[model samples]
Target: IALNAWQDTPLYNDKERAALALCEKLTLSQNIDDDFYLVLAELFDQPSLVTLTVAINAINSWNRMVKMFKPTVEFNER
Candidate 1:
């Protein structure tokens, strides 16, 4: 709920907001401009930034796989 309205809510700090913005842009295939990069750099160090990018990409890839495969789960009664 709060996350759905992240921009409006005050629950997130600057770093979280920046990360969320990056996630949204990456997920939506939107362009990440130089200014946004600067914002991210200011908020995170180089290694941290690389890790965040990798994590976001990994999640996106997993989402794509799930959508394409539509894997099912089966449960057994005890």
Candidate 2:
């Protein structure tokens, strides 16, 4: 079930599917018009939607920074 959600398969409910679609769409295209807001409005409140958008953008920015910086990662086995 969790794997299906991660893979954006159709094993989830409408709201979850919609949210995943929005994230994928935004991440790939970096565009969201009024139609997307209308669909998202059905699932999340205005404030929550705003927060979601901000959070996604922040994550995208962070990922870009990480890629640009090419930070060294060291993992110590426990």
Candidate 3:
């Protein structure tokens, strides 16, 4: 409800809102409380899970690699 109550407009749909709410409710259930898991679930709920899953897998691999060695992302280019 916090997100809904915020000043900014809601940029999320019902499914996304539901997932966000479910993530925060922490209702004695699966590990949907995690944003990563919830986002993953929402992403999987899409028709093309295969494509996104592949991307997710790649991102997971990249994240693991980056975590192993603190990657210094350059955002200073102006």
Candidate achieving the largest lDDT: 1
What is the descending TM-score order? 1, 2, 3
Backbone clashes in model 3 = 0
Q: Relative to the true structure, how large is the alpha-carbon lDDT of every model?
A: 0.97, 0.79, 0.56
Give each model a TM-score.
Answer: 0.89, 0.71, 0.39
For residues 1-78, could you state the per-residue lDDT of candidate 1 as single tens digits? 599999999999999999999999999999999999999999999999999999999999999999999999799989
Measured by TM-score, the strongest candidate is: 1
Off by over 4 Å in 1: 74-78
| Candidate 3, residue 58: how far the Cα is off, in Å | 1.1
| lDDT score, candidate 2, position 13 | 81
User: For residues 1-78, what per-residue lDDT tens digits would candidate 2 score against the true structure?
Assistant: 675456556577877776777778777975778897788899999888888878877887889999999999899999
Give one clash count per candidate, in the order shown.
Answer: 0, 0, 0
| Poorest lDDT segment (10 consecutive residues) of candidate 1 | 1-10
lDDT of 2 at 11: 70
- List the candidate 2 regions with Cα displacement exceeding 4 Å: 1-8, 75-78
